[model samples]
Target: MLQDARSVASRSSQEAEIAGPASPEFIDFDRLLAAVRRQWRLVAVLGLIGLLLGIAYVMTAVPRYTASSNLLIDQGSNRIVDELSTSGGSIEDESGILSQVELLKSDQIGNKVIDALHLTSDESFMHSSVSLLRRVKLAVVSVVDISSWFRAPEEEADDEAEKRLTALALLGNDLDVARVGRSYVLSISYTSPDPVMAARVAQAFANAYLADQLDSKYEATRRASSWLQQRIDELRQKSLETDLAVQRFRAEKGLIAADGRLVSDQQLTELNSQLTLAQADVATARAKMDRIQSLLESGDTNSVVNDALASTVINELRTKYLDAAKRQAEISNRLGNDHAQAVRLRAEMENYKQLMFSELGRIAESYRSDLQVAQAREAAVQRSVADATSVSAGANETQVQLRELEREAETYRNLYQTFLQRYQEAVQQQSFPITEARVITDAQVPTAPSKPRKPLVLAISLFIGLAAGSALGAFREFRDRFFRTGDQVREELGLAYLGSVPHVKDKALAIPTQKAGTGTEASDRYLRANNAVARYVLDHPLSSFAETLRSAKIAADLAISHQKKIIGVISVLPSEGKSMISANLAELIASHGSSAILIDGDIRNPGLTRAVARHATAGLLEAVMDERPLKDCILVDPETKLALVPAVVKHRVPHTADLLSSVNMTTLLDEASNAFDYVVLDLPPLGPVVDVRAIAPRIDAFIFVVEWGKTARRVVRSTLAANPQIAEKTLGVILNKVDTEKMKLYRDFGSDEYYTSRYSSYYHQGK
Candidate 1:
């Protein structure tokens, strides 16, 4: 159990280190709700103030009437003049519509409206009523103008020009022009104090915009026409000059032509065709002549060469030769030996064959003649082709310059035609002027004013006020760093929370002196008058304050299993009522039939001695220094039998911490432990002194006291951390001097303090 308590203490120290002081790692909504409940009055008052201001503004503000006119940027209307006009005729896209919107808001349109309405001369339009917000702004500016005292004299100005400029500026300021969504429709709005004037101004702005568009288009078309006319005249002159140059160059170069082609070119084409035919004829003739010659050389007289020649004499001789050969063969068969008739027939066949050869030679000679004629024709045609080629080549060289001149003439002619057409279109467009913008809805007078929306303004003001109040409340909550309840003590120090002691007022701290009484009664009255808060536990044993001391006593008993326990009661800082708690706790324990001794161990500043035993001359300091008997220096209450060893400060003791840590102090506590059932020591605080740390080893357990809503959580955590032995030995923490009324504000739903009201009747206080 002791090890577990130590571990919890160690873990709590680690958490304190990690979270620092008031770290906002996690938000506790319950705490926030409690804070809101506590500070709701502040938030409500701020919001009410904001609401009143908003109401005053609404009541005093000037109302402005707004009139609207709608314009449709007709992109389709441009199609009527799109083909004829050279200028842009229609709004193309969103950007074009926005451009038109900007044009409507331009100073040119504003000037036109001002002139049309004669706004410069009209007092209502020239000097409208100023708004409350504007008045406040002007007042602030005048007050803050530091240069007004040293400013130089103003120069004379032109009134009329200034009025005109001011009117234009006012018109621009009150005008609102915007394109409606993705469409080519513009909404123009004007605001003024007068309804009729507002409508008139809005309508005038629309008229001015339309007129501007028409005038711009007309001017553009007129300029285009003039430019096109000038270009047409220049192009006509250029066209004539180029045409003349082409004719002069053609004639000078002698590039004569028949039809579309030159004469020399035609002649070359004809000669080339003739050369091709002549070459073909030559090939045919040579082939025939070669065929006949081959037949004659092979001696094949009876071959088809002779037949192909179609000679009557050669055919007759061939027939007669065949008959003779047939007759010779028959005669040789009849006459066995060399027959004379067969020999004679053979000689006749030979003669016929020779005649056929002679005929074939004649045919071959005719073929050779035909071949020579074809060769000569081919040669003549080739020579003519060569001559034509040379002539055509020269004509072609001259045609290059002719082609260049023709191209130049063609270009001028085409340009002249194009300019003439465009000139006609420009003229048409100039005569028929049209604008892409037109009014779709005329401006109408508004029934109500558009300024000073009361409900919305009030709501916004209230919201802002509430937000600011909430911020301030949260800051206050963050700045509240002191402990207010037992939960805070347990969570911050990792010690068990014993209980809370109710705050005792100064009147309650002083007991009324009783009129003369018995010896026992007189002694009790003296003790009570001297320290009523410490003696309060005896009179009100069942009260919450006394119950808290009992709880501490129980915790001390649980922490130390020894029969005699030396428990130290310590606090982080001085004046936290630890001395009173120590005295009360010892008295409460002694009243329970236990022998308890109360010792004022704070030798440096003996607050307990001053409150309880101020008349004592010797104390723990005297006993430790001079080895005095504990009984001689101790003061015992006659009623409760509680003993107290107060430190009597006769002089300044510089080494009180050393004296507390000395062997004599240890021996004194051991001797007291042997006599008393409980040894409670009222030690000095841990913040400004090290006496508690010096004697912490001798203490078996400690009860830490923290003044409610006074001692900082950081101070307690740091003091315990500086003295780990005290933190380890601490049995629990007791909250002293708690304001019970304010304590309810810090309690969450399930905490013990939340149920304090329900259990209040359980304890009674003696008056």
Candidate 2:
């Protein structure tokens, strides 16, 4: 009992948290269990469907084949090799090889590969990877230029190479090329329907690069050979003259085998290039240097503009005007020349553009006009350089003119020195020319194609199908909650199951009339639905059903040995299950040989006529309204073990609950209770005209009927709550028509109860 109470409380608390205050009270646990039980079939079907779909997907999906090849990249010059150069070649190169990876992936090399592979004639190779993300960095600008192949179908040639190109263009989309680690190797992988083709394509790319590199080296050698030949002739004359001039100078200065300026010719060339760039940069950085130095020296908090005649604002405005003019001209081209709007825009654009260029020239000239300032900046730098110690010649420009001949001779002398070293290396290079880059391994034609995985597709398809089925099953459950489970009667209306009868299998439906032509044995099968429901209530009396009242009375009777309780029946809504409750309970209870009285309390709308007939000319309405004796109003039956009191209303002035709850009605019930084992009150449903509330407090127990999905929860709650006496003493709720297809869905155990219903029996037997 404690456990049951705890479970109920916990469940109610959970419901409150989930559904807030609007949640309907909990129904009978057995009914919910039954509903879930009934839906087990749907769950099974949907689950099976999901499983089958998954299996089907596993079967039909295409398998993708993969082919991979590698390329080793010699990323940068050997750093250690350069350090070990005791031969005195050049300074140590400090830059790492990682930065050189980007340079290798630059457009020049990529274009070379593209041209060599003839990708310009095949567009498919350009989109080597998906947009936004790639397996390797793209050398092209965001998009691969595949315009050559896709130019036009008409442009495609009829040759076999062109045909292969077409197919290659299509298939190349599956191929991916990227540089291998830091070595001089590259990895090319491709997925295709045919594995051999994938491998062949990858190998083709490698061969193409090798061929391109050889061609490039040969061209460089040719250019170098031509350049060296020209220098050889030019230096012949300069070499002889330099020797003569040196000898003459030597005689005049009385000097012997002296040092020459040719010692740093290479260094002088590098310094000259650097100086030229520095001069151009110096022009721009002077104003900046002055501003920065002034701030550093003066420690100023605010900036001071130095040039009063500065034309930056004007120059900037002019630049914008030029851009706008260009845009206007471009737009004008898209239109006609003689168009008035176009002509006006073009004129305005040209005028602005000219103004901008003129303004920039004017600005440059203004700066040049300040020659004194430029000279002053140059002089400061010159002073700084003068203080710096010199290691090379040509440090100052003032030492010139007569030194040109000397410079020429020195250049020739440096060339001779380089030739002497090259001559020595060339001898060794020929003897010990090692080939480290010979092919380590050759690629082979792959035996598989890597693509079209149908299994993955089928798997996804299966998931979609099962998900669709499961969703549909869930929706099917929401249509009806009444006949769905036994708990419905108890939880929804605070009623109880009387008792449930097993559904008879394949029983012939035969409605024996009042004449009893078929006998009682055959009739039992016809009325199995009503009997089964009554039996169900004996076990589970979750709510206020009269069965709950019966169970309570029966339990209370356990101590007393034999005590019966009188139960009053009512429903919040009219025509829900009040009539069924009276007839079925009376019939089922009497089947056990217990005497039961069915008092039809609805005087205005008597229900006994449709269910059973009793002798009654003047009934309870006349007795209650006119104060007739209790014995005369009630009728006793010996054959069925039941009694009936028909209302004499005949749709006349109704005898209300106020009349029934009077001392007269109470005295009548008291007498009947002593005479019968059980007394059933068929009370009026709650509505505007019925006085059900007035007589509620007078009942020993009451049964409320909620016709499954038909009765509104709000109507029942409101109407019941309005009658506190009835709500408190309510026996429980009974869900009627719970066997309707809608309600039967909640009946986990499939039964043929419908086939043997009284109506079914009556209809089938007649047919």
Candidate 3:
């Protein structure tokens, strides 16, 4: 049976460890909701404060009005001077629009606006109404000007210049310029306390921007015209000087030109053409002469002699010779040889051949004459070509310098014409300057203030306040290491949770004072009810405090089946109501007609002795050290018949642990066990002393009492873990001094405590 009880206790501990504290990996929504419920008051209070602050801000804040003006940067507006405009009368791209926006925001435009409006002298523009917050800030800065003391003095600026700069800076601060997305339009806005002033400032900004643009363009054109004039004069002078230099160079080098070409070059070209023709003529005449001479030398006169020298005469002579030869042959055939007529015919043929030869020789002589004339002409042309070549070569060498001078002169002349044209354009542009930017929509006074939005400010303030409150609440929850519910006792210490005991004050349980005439029985009753907490179980048996003790009794009975179970009431820290629990539990057990005894085991402090047996001088100490009988040291309860062996301390007892662990102490408990059905010992807390550990082995079971929301959970777990024997013998834990109403907020939906209110009527409280 003892082994079975031990096994059951061990299994309960193992289950408690398995169902220990919730893992950090997952969020427990029930716990979070419970925390929120507990901290709702704090959150509400902070949110209310934030709402009040927002109301104050809305009431005290200065109203600011914003007026806006729209200006269009027309790309074609400058087309009146398009021929002279350097920007080509067109905005190039997005960058150009952005540049215009920047220009509108520049100090140049800002100063112009300031000067035009005379903001430096206008009191409304120079000094606006300050808000309450700003006043407070200025006051703080004046009070905490520690750096000013250490700063070195500097020279002051001119009054006029300083005023101008200050006005410019103020204008810049109030001015807002932006390009209307992807378009050549600028939006200029100004904020001020006065609506009229805002409109005026906005209009001033637009006017100033347009005026500045016009002034910039006029200045650029004027400077360009002046520079062009100077450049034109220099170019004209240079043109005249270069022209003179070209003429002088040409005369010095004798480079005379004709029809856009040099005279020497033309002469060389004509001589080359004549030389080529003369060579061709010489070749033709030489070929004709050589052909006729070769024909004559070959001596073939009877063959058709075609010569340049009168071919008709040669043809006539040949015909005649042929006729004569025919006659000579006829006669020679008719008459005999040696006839005079036949001989005369043969002589005529000879005469015709000689005349053909003579004619051929004369033709060859004429060919030779033509050849000589062609050769002479070729020679004469060759000489003329050589002379022309010499002249052309000299001219080419001098032309290098001449060409350079010509090029310089041409460059100067071109520059002079170009500058003159540009000067004319610049003059035109200067005469008619135009600005591309113009106000399309003039600024109007705003009907309502633009800042200090009350609703939005209130909402944001509330949100921030709530967020802050939640952060603090979460920090409080994180630091809440104390036990609130019975579940905490079980989960943290791995022990069964019996129940919770209410914190019953003595005034609430008001015990009547004993009269002088009252008997011994009445006095004993008064003494028994002296401590309301210790005697609560007897007076109110139906209360939750009494019920918790009953549950502890049942747990003790189940854990230890001995005839006289020795149950030790223990706590991790002092003042956790362990003595009260021990006294009440013994009284509750004895009220059922079972004999029980309470022992004050804390020899060092002996709180139980002071509570119940205050008049007793000697009790457990006398029983253990003086060897007195336990019955003589015992005090019996008047109502429940519960016995108590109080530890009466006359002086400091240094070896309280040794006395508790001595054989005499064990014998004293043994005697109590034989005489009573149960022995309840109010042992010292496990944290402060070692008395509980020394007497743990002798005890049958222990009922751990923890102060509700007072004792740290880690202290209990660590104390129990340090003494495994005491932990194993522990029957269960009881949460003492619980605030039942507050505990309701900490309960989960499915927990036993969640339904505690439903069954609370079953338990009645006695005054």
Candidate 4:
């Protein structure tokens, strides 16, 4: 009971929020668990699909082989030659030790291997020999033939040799390289079906590199020798030309040859003597010219005459000195003899006069001597000077020529020496046993080829397959709209359910039966024998949906008799237990042994007959039209003591809606209530038909039966408003088809999650 109350309260609270087809809107883990439980079969099927894909992947995939070479790339190898030095060249190293492995992988080395192994093919080998389509074919074909072909052959081999060559080339491609650690040893591995081919390919790599190193050394030697010979010839020519120039100069000058067959020591010594003499002459000339110019600049006013002028040159010189002394004396007389500047100037003037007189004496003597010497001797001296000048000019020209020859010769000599040394070194290196970088490890041929993981592909396909299947199942679950849960009936309609009639999967449901007559009340009796058999559903006052149902029913029964004689049946949609309402009410009332007659007034789709079985006829139609008398038209159920009027018609006319709502229907309603204890009318939904409006005022009160979540209160309210006075006689709502299990849940909780917030408040307050 507590559990049912909690469920009702929870549904009521949830209905306040989203207003859904109310069970408890709160989907607890249990309900979710239930939904998942239902889908477990689907999950299992999908899982099986996933497993199949995984298996398929494992079965159909191509086996992939990876051949890796382990190499110890010595990090310290770079430092190996930092301490080594050549005469003038730097250490020829590219990270010395580690780069050895890289060189093995170099195109130069690899190309050598390719050439030695003859791996390059003309056209077909360039593109992938096996691809996705080809692989699929191979996979399919491989199923039948074990040794068909590793890869499809492009052109059929013409001969055995060609076939073997092609096979070898195909197997050669499975080669790879890598550094293992900081070790110096490298392990090279190649992948191929033939183990011999793998080892051969690795050995081919080492041989190719060794051959390249030897070729490099030989080429280097050849180049060096060629360059050196050319340089030696050029230098020899220059040396000869320099020697020839010296010889030619000596020959042209008629100079004595040196003891060494070029120029003599005596000739050189003589040239040096002449050079000194010439230099002395130039110095003397320069000195005289400078003195003459200095004299001119000093403005020496005193001059001395020569002996030929019949003058005492010395006396003239002395007179000038005397004049200078007189001038000095006059200045001294005026300014005093002790005056420093005047004294100094007088002394300087006297010294200048003495120097002039001395120089005059020397010049007079020189002039006499010049006159005495011959004019022929002067001419001869000029000739000697001219000859010396010509020789000096010739010598300077030779010096410039010598300089040019020397510079050219020096340049060639240096280059010749360099090339000679380089050539010598190359010859030396070639003579010795030079060790070149060699591959230590051969490539290991891989046994398996890598690609086309079939198991993984199949696994993915299976996953997709299962997803497709489960989605289909879920879609069916969503499309079914029968009142799936008892809570849905109660909450959506603002009504509560009395009970659920569990699905009795009886085969009898399929048996077609003639529509029962008014005497068919026996079925109802079997259905409801005890209150326990009735599945009494009590509403909780704490539940909002129950409150809504409570409000709607109280409003519907505002003007009712003690027994609530007037009953207004409504449903959220058509055929939602409204007919059930009429039947059950009659059954309940009749059980009290109070006279009750059920009216089948739903002119359209009259299903009251289906529920009561006694009224599935045109008796109600006959009575309204005055075709049948009340006593004859009325039906009395044998088992339930409930009377049913049947409108069992031969042909159902369209105007039955109008006839049931006519004044005659009202008169019939008043008269039937007087005759029987209670008259229950099974009207069509207020939405579908309007027969109730005409008959409602005569009713004392009404009872609305709503399947738990199947009916909406707003619909009931609107239908009630159509006959406002009768609507007031509503005796409250009865929730039909309530699930006992679900009812217990909300009843214990007493609200949905939204309203459950107050739980803490109340719980804390209680604490």
Candidate 5:
């Protein structure tokens, strides 16, 4: 049951080792900071280079000055003539102002300024300056004609048009036009090498714009006047022709007009008046005749009332008849029949009645004659009016034509007069000069150049440099694949990190020791003289470096189950200080009055044998192969009383793997296990040979040594991966040659705890 449990535990340990540690959380900021810190030197160098480049640009760049001129465009001002200026006032939108802006930027204004200032002939405005670098580039381009590979090459010929275009482009580049806020003011700026030229060009632009505006207005007025004059002359001739046509029509049709009345119209008016008078006369005469006839028919002379009644003859006749009737009536009453006087009176009364009848007949006959005459006149006058109306009707057509001609003449005359007045007004306006814009402020020579802002350029340069440096630093940090701290060793290799050994100032004197005797004194003197890093536990046990090794010793003791634990110190590659770890660990154990021995297992190299060379004549090779006693090969340090089996020999043994696994080597280990409390072997690096693999099963445990921030994690992992049998026996990992100051940059696994500022006081130089 116990065996099964042990097998299960072993499997669990292998699984845990293979699984490695959990992946660390991805803290981008921490990682970025660490990467920057790792390559801060490179960043600094690049930043310095950028600063120099900025300085050089500031020193070499050309200076330019800008001068501006302001103009007030009176958009709200009244025009010369309200009627002639048919163009509407400024709109509520920006279109009118924008159009003015475009006008200022147009080639017309630009060319005027250019000509006035003689800028077309000036080299500063027309020609571009070529730098040395540009000249070199041109030379190279002329020498090599590789452009043909991409397209058909053509000749670069210069012409008059090209020259004008180049000059125009240069002029445009130097000129700038902008509207000043929401006002009617426009700002015109010009840049040049000379401050005087800049100011002169700006002022010239404003003057040219004003002159052009005035000329435009004058030309418009002149054209309008010319057109109006032509139209007025034509209207005058039309008016004359219409008047002459009216007079000619009147003469041809024999129609005359007076006071707006025609000759035919007068004739019609006279005929109508005569006809009315004749009808009135006829009616009066007919009324008188009818009254007279009525009186005669009735035979009632006394009842008749007329103007004829007032006539003397008619009145006398009527009076006589009435007297005779009265006398006859009186006689008839007095005398009976056959009276002579009565008969005679009746005869006289009859005679009187007859006379009265005759007189009324006479008056009636006279009225009837007058009526006949008046009727005759009325008939004649009616015939005459009819005839006159016929003649007037004929003349009416000609009169209508004459009236139409008169109307046309009148209309032409009115139009002619209006055009003539308008033409005079246009002529007067043509002499008046006006402009839409005026200069508000004239440009002056500037005192300082506007370009080459030193501080801004330097600041930009510094920012660009820092960005580039940071990018490069990040790239370098990503490219490096080495372990930097104990956390990296534990996380990547899946091995327990025992401790870190801080890099001491002195190599050999890091361990403090008191002189024991001559022999020990001589060895110390040799170690101190040769400058080797060895035997720290026997010298200064209180030192951090010595304490770290002591911790490794304790780790090994706790890990190994064997009573006499055989611990082997091994590394993935060379130069990892495995031999140093072995020496220190053994010395640390022996310092506690424990029987400990260090073996030189690396026959090929024998680093420990060389470190203590005086007593390393006969080593483990002789003990294992030459049938010599193990005690004969044992070398003891007199001060620490540490036993060592060195590998110093005349020639290195071949097939070192076979030799380490031989029976003699095993018997020697077993015997040493019985005599010593701990056995430390300084084995060859696991990468270069199979010696460590051959000797791994014989040892109780293995101590893996890694160079801090130097050994790649893949190398250490691959070394153990290839030899799984030895990996299972690994006690823990030791990170040596740690830069305590640099280790503060890493925060994972609490790596800074052992190397922080508070721990610096615990580290001291061994006395």
Candidate 6:
């Protein structure tokens, strides 16, 4: 029979393990939502803290006003000179506009503004709020003399230099330069504690920038003019010397040519021109002659060749040939091929055509004659040019030297003239230089501060706080190693989750069944509340808690069949409500019309004994020691009619474990098993002592009780590991003190309509 109960308990444990709550290893959105919902107070508190911080910042922060001055940079061309044109077209390139922005922020303009405004002496400008910390640090450095450890530090700068550097730094920090989109416009903004000062500085920056541009242009022009002036004087002197040298050499050697050109120079020029014309004439005549000759050979008549046939004899021959051909055509049209008149006309026309051929040959000969004359003229001009070149070569070496000197003189003269022209332009530009950039919009007095954007800061703070709070909540949830759900027990510890017992509010109602009519009003109220909770199986049998208890009962029945009814209830830690489970389980078995005995096996803390038999002097210990009869130690509850063996001893037992494993105790359990259909022992917490281990072998199976969301996994695992025999006897773990309302937060856990109680109001509709 005991073997059968063990088999049933083992089978029940396995089934419970399989049918536990869903594990968190899978996606569980409901669990995450529940976690956030449960920790909302923390989120709200953190958000409030962030909001307060934002408010403090707004209250304590200094208001800074930003005044912007927009300047339109006409980058198309330099106003001073078109020679200094830029590649900037209608639209400015990214780099071009960015460079303009950089120019606006440059130190040159910064220094100019500083000097113009005399800001170097302004305390706020020299030591703005932005560098207050730095100023304090400098003050400290000036006072401290910690040069003993290291080499002596360098001496500080004079007040003027320090003030200048501080102003520069402050100016840089206060200035903001940005391009206005893709346009050739720049926005120069200045920030200051004083609104009017900000506006003044911004406007001054634009003015200073424009003035700097004009000054630079004028300076460049002045420098150019100075260089040109010096260069022009040098060039003029050099030109005069070259001219004098040329004239002296020409006079000394008489190598100067009239009209600034030698006879050979004129001859070469005239020869080259005539040679070109002669060559062109020869080519034209040759081409015409070739055309006439080709026409004569092919027997083709053309007007161009008629020029070669300009002879009177040829003209008469051509006219006679045409008259003869006309008469032949007239006769051929009037008579047949065999007619006498047509034959005579044909003979006459043939004779005339032969004469015309002779005349054409004469014209071709004339064209050849003209081509020869052109070639002769070309050769004559060539000879004249050669003679002229030879005559010029006979001139002395001084002539070449004179030419070189003249060329040098002319070159210097041109350079001097060019420099003189540029110098005049430069002087004119220096007098009035134009700036490329202009102020599109002047800086206006700022009406408000740009810093301390309250709403934006508050919004950012809220987001950060929310993120931090959520992270903290998640961290806490992750750090917790307890069994938050029955699935944790099943998945992590590989233990079966028998069932969960909802947290009972009224402990008095959870008391073991006592004698009827002996209960007071307080006890009745406690009983009612308990009936709705821990004792739900008796009063609210159809409730979720009751259903959970019945499930556990079913599992116990499976693990321990009718033949083996001796079961032990234990937990890993105290306050797990194992005693209550044991007592209730006993009552459940008794209500099934089976005799069930409940025993308090925990001698150290006799919870069951205190609840069932408060005034009893002797119980398990005395019965085990044979100091009292076993029947005298057993108490029968009148309400449940279940037999109870409470551990109500007057004095503590030194060797409680030894007493529990004694032969008398074993015999007592054996007799109780025989007398009752079911025996339940409320054992000590498994984690706190080894008493449970000693009794583990005596009991058929154990109902391992654990407080839901409270029992640490490490404690349960370590306790079970330390006592392998007890672990083996454990039928399954019972999760006590479950928050059912909280469980509904996880959609998957309590989505069932039955658990939600769709008709919950039906029970109290008439009550």
Task: List model 1 lDDT by residue over 1-767, tens digit each.
Answer: 45644644354446556867764648787777779887788888888888888888899878889999999987666543455455645568777778888888888888888889888899977767444555575568668977765666574346987788667767777889987888888999998989999999999999999899788778777777787788889999999999999889878877778898878888899999999999999999989888888888998865766345577888788889899988888998998428888888889989999988888888888989999999999999999999889988888888888888899999999989988987777776677688887899999999999877878989988998888788888787888899887667768777777889999875755563423436753443233336678778887888999888888887766667667889899998899999989988988999999998999988878888887777676778779999999887787776777888888889999998999999999999999999999999999899998888888888888888999888889988988888887888887788899998788888887677879999989888863
Sort by lDDT, best first: what order?
3, 1, 5, 6, 4, 2
Candidate topping TM-score: 1
Between candidates 2 and 4, name the one with more favorable TM-score.
4
lDDT of 3 by residue, 1-767 (tens): 34534554564457656878545748888888999999998888888888888889899888889999999987766544445545564566887788888888888888888778888888766667444555576568657977756666574456787677657766766678888777778899998899999999899889988888787788878877787788888999999999999899888888889899999999999999999999999999988887787888887765433463348888788789889988998999999547999888888889998888788888889889999999999999999999999989989989988889889999999989877887776776677788887889999999999878888999988987888888888888899999898667656776778889988787776663423326764454334446667777777888989888888888777767677899899998999999889888998999989999889999998898888778776699999999998877877776667888888899899998999999999999899999999999999989989999999889988888999989989888888889988887877888999888788889987676888989999899863
- Per-model TM-score, in order, reads 0.67, 0.40, 0.66, 0.40, 0.56, 0.58
Candidate 5 local lDDT, 1-767, one digit each (tens)? 22322332244346556968646766766656666666787888888888888999999988888999999877665465434545743323577777777887888987788679876567765544334564575568656867634653355445654456555555577788898998878899988778888899899989988998888778877877787778888998999999899878878887877887776778789888988998999999998888878888887757665755777886887788788778777877888535788788778877776777787788888888898999999999889888888888888766778778888999999988877887777777777767778899999999998877889888888778887998887776776678776556656766666778877545436344434546753543322212246765555677777877776777666665556788899998887888878887888888888899889899899877776644456779999999699987887766667788888668757889999999999999998889899989999999888899888778877778888878888888888778877777776777888887777766543344434567767766553
**What lDDT does candidate 3 reach at residue 351?**
93
lDDT preference between candidates 2 and 4, better one: 4
The ten-residue window of minimal lDDT in model 6 covers 522-531
Q: Write the per-residue lDDT of candidate 4 for residues 623-737, one digit (tens) a residue.
A: 7786466766665655456777755556667776578667777677767877887677777666765656566656554555555445555566556556555434444355555
Clashes of each: 0, 61, 0, 69, 1, 4
TM-score (C-alpha) between model 6 and the true structure: 0.58
Runs of candidate 5 exceeding 4 Å displacement: 1-49, 67-121, 124-129, 133-191, 198-446, 505-529, 652-654, 747-755, 759-763
True-vs-predicted CA distance for residue 562, candidate 6, Å: 4.1
C-alpha local distance difference test of each model: 0.82, 0.52, 0.82, 0.53, 0.76, 0.73
